[model samples]
Target: EGLRKAKSRLMEPLMQVDITTPEEYMGDILGDINGRRGMVGDLGERGNIKTISAQVPLANMFQYVSTLRSMSKGRANYSMKLANYDFVPPNVEEELKKGFVLETEED
Candidate 1:
């Protein structure tokens, strides 16, 4: 197909995320964010609470509310909005392409 002959890449949305949590949970929160492929940005504190800012892919944020609640013992809060789109990692792109091919072949 013409599409296959052309150069194309898969992209995914990235989000700007800010999280506020008790100081005690800072380490756990940071670890979790990193594990989710988030790039940590700013860190700040207010009283016993800490604030963390990061950019994370939207795909990694599904059901994040539940994860945050459990990790922070219901004490952390976060907000995220779409920041931009970036190319998917090569491995993920390959998997997506394989799935797409399977779906098209079944039709």
Candidate 2:
């Protein structure tokens, strides 16, 4: 099937994201990022806000906007763009293999 051919080629997209929040919130934010299989590429502080830049897989980033908003209590802001795809880590791939069954987009 055409889908099989695409899978054989193994194409995916990477994304770069910028997140801003108070310095006190960095630990919670960093934990969430790591939970989503993201790597922090850079981090810095500007006045009262901490800025973090990261690269994450597109698949793992789905519905991330709402999740971030809820986690930060609407105090955080984020932006992201497509970068390039890279192979997923073996552990993450194994976990995803268990399958994701979502009842709705909100899930």
Measured by TM-score, the strongest candidate is 1
TM agreement with the true structure for every prediction: 0.90, 0.74
Q: Point out where model 2 deviates above 4 Å.
A: 1-11, 91-107
Rate residue 50 of model 1 by lDDT.
92
- Superposed on all Cα atoms, the candidates' RMSDs to the truth, in angstroms, are 1.3, 5.8
lDDT by residue for model 2 (1-107), tens: 46445664344588998999977778988998888778899999889899999987788898988888888888899999998888776666545544532333347
Which residue runs does candidate 1 get wrong by more than 4 Å? none
Residue range 1-107, candidate 1, lDDT tens digits = 56678868878999999999999899998999998889999999988889999999999999999999999889999999999999998988889889999999999
